[model samples]
Target chain A: MGGPRRLLLISNSTLHGGGYLGHCQQHIQKFLGQNVKRVLFIPYALHDRDAYARTARAKFESLGYGLDSIHEFCDPVEAVRKSEAIFIGGGNTFRLLKALYDNSLIHEIRKRVLEDGIPYMGSSAGTNVATISINTTNDMPIVYPPSLKALGLVPFNINPHYLDPDIKRTHMGETREERIRQYHEEPNTPPVLGLREGTMLLVEGDKATLQGVTGARLFLRGKKPTEHEPGTDFSFLLNDSNASNL
Target chain B: MGGPRRLLLISNSTLHGGGYLGHCQQHIQKFLGQNVKRVLFIPYALHDRDAYARTARAKFESLGYGLDSIHEFCDPVEAVRKSEAIFIGGGNTFRLLKALYDNSLIHEIRKRVLEDGIPYMGSSAGTNVATISINTTNDMPIVYPPSLKALGLVPFNINPHYLDPDIKRTHMGETREERIRQYHEEPNTPPVLGLREGTMLLVEGDKATLQGVTGARLFLRGKKPTEHEPGTDFSFLLNDSNASNL
Candidate 1:
């Protein structure tokens, strides 16, 4: 189906002791490839669009690719239609999804990435919106979108910047694991991928692989979450029927 | 109106290394007083209603108050009407709010607490819904409610189990302070009270006092958050006009 949908979903933009997008530089560069000369950026998650654009532009340019934010374009849908690659940076997932819906870019971007086969890259909130829903996000509902339904670029949901429970901490707030389990308690939810900091899932065609230094956790509805190390094949999750069987 | 609407909004039910509700026993006992003999409990936040109700009923019984869960009754609205006091224990904010809407108890509970002057108590997720909206909750959006609009028993919003930023940690997820600031960036957001664990807000009529062992941080739009001690008065927040001026 259209030469396999290409996507690079990163967990966090900046890892500990690193600059913005510093940790995932090589992976992003390789994902873009030599043929792609430009990238379309979506910086709607944060309140300040101009500042977000500046940070992203500097990093993308350093890697030899010109970057233009979709916010700067009068016709954002048209801009997506002509982009070589699309990158949505991290921020609040609700705000990001709301902006995507408000701009009416959901279907246009979906078609561009899924049907036309353009490379799509997302970090944190950007990565979250690429999944079935943002129900598993670790963010406050500062703003309400029309719905929790996301772009559905992938078959499963994602919890970016997923942190393990600090057994020593006295705070009674539900752990990240407990929160995701609650999501699964609701009927008919898809699988959830808990992407730790400095980790990402790279999708090329029908194959998806866990990539980065840290490991990711795969959570199914009725089973205990299984740990997956870096370089693990997550391609089974790309197919709905295959994922359900797992 | 009705002898200064009474509410005991707690930050958490269990303090670190403490038994459930053990830390807040005295405050709860004082709030309920000798006048109220029974408490109607809402334990819809967690998946197991029976288990939640049992935990709550045991705790309330030890405090010399008879407790019955709303789920046990055929008429939840009538249950609210006849209840001497109400206690909503915490688990997940979204799930609690969704269940509240599903059972059509928002208006009923509001009338019982605000208009009838019955003492209403909440912990964590429960404290979140007592505020204007659950926009500042620390919990995940595991379930989507009909609206983020909560019971609005209080004028301001709350971030319960609020933790200060851990300077030593390398995690890139937004700190509680940063998340609340992002909420403030949205238009017309209420002032957020960062209720640290082992702390709570006791609302008596027009007066709200920061109680428990720890302090709280108050956040307002376009201003730095101010630290408030345990005995600090927050009556100004009860009046929307007064809160805006501050």
Candidate 2:
């Protein structure tokens, strides 16, 4: 067994014309399973912490699962320990990493999700934290997190809401392709999984499958991005070879 | 006079159809003046060290100024100390900051520009480093720098190549405006100056004026984004009062 590396890494929480978490409700419910009655939500990415928590709680409650935001708990580390399922929603990645590091919940959450076998699900910035580091995130570094180190639930780094290069665009802003190419410059940086919006990766121990109709992009240094079709087996991405792939 | 805090902070290096440093070459030449004959170029923002320097040298040479890239120097700190004028070209802010810190040139460069009054010109990521921090940069954090602390040449932070929110765009990613708003959520984070492409800011002493044809957006927390027309005074952005103004 590849240990309990269960993950529901979503590219975005909300899609075009969909309510918050609307598009992925069934996938989320199915992923959590009937056994996990409660989930600890991490809503630190947004400014309105309470409102973000409430929104997630509403969705979880409707699915017959309870969601309590870590912000409400007296001790966040303790909350991670007791959480049967961890659901991290999308927002600013820097803010989320800042909160995670500030509360010293990084190790506790990593242990809970990767070792104890608690089902871990994340969207956007949430999915960003599940990877090796927050390096590939598109969010502005609004706040300084102590470190970019994040829970290494996945072997490779993830770029959620991954966008393709729009050749027609005249904007000088670096395209998604160029940005990831720059990421490859860093020595020892991991390969990136470009999870497009409406696309999600479902991990059941050793295997990770692209769950949505849309395909995801995989980026390796010095190589053109290769598209991974839905249902493509990405188990090789988690192997020990990845830690040294760079 | 605190020497001459002459700053030519450009929003972007190039426009759509323009050549490298196109659309602003005349402004750069005018800003540098006849006295400054040479410039020390910091091309750390680009992944290719030598190629970036060569390209920049080509442009500076055509402009009748000799450009010496810091990468070639034996002691980078010495190079900064001896630079007649400094030109920081733009690419990746994280990479730029990382190189600066790794070489221990952050303080030296800051002193050369802010205190020594070296004529400092920068574009895109280059302008980002001159701000309070590189927190608002659009580049991916491919590598972790020791800290986000950058040259506080200006009191406010800068968001270079700033694009406005497009209401018609259905992408779930946070718009430029929304991202800056999220930056405001940080308690001590400085106000961000959203500099649109093709525009630049000219700072002389404590006074700063928005240059180029387009106006710039000023984002102060709890207040609507107010536009400052080109040639309007922006000295207030550098005041001690600015900290509390937000």
| Top-DockQ candidate index | 1
Against the native complex, each candidate's DockQ, computed on alpha carbons, is 0.89, 0.88
State the DockQ, from 0 to 1, for candidate 2: 0.88
Per-model TM against the reference: 0.98, 0.97
Record all residue pairs in model 1 with backbone atoms less than 3 Å apart, i.e. clashing: B4-B205
Task: Check candidate 2 and list the clashing pairs.
Answer: none
Error of 2 at B28 (Å): 0.8
Off by over 4 Å in 2: A1-3
- Tell me the RMSD of model 2 versus the true structure: 1.6
* lDDT of each residue in A1-246, candidate 2, tens digit only: 115779999999999999888889999989987888889999989989999988898888888887788999999999998888899989999999988999998999888877888899999999999998999999999888988888889888899998888777889888998899898877777789998899999988888889886779999876788998888898888885865664
Q: Model 2 residue A197 lDDT?
A: 93
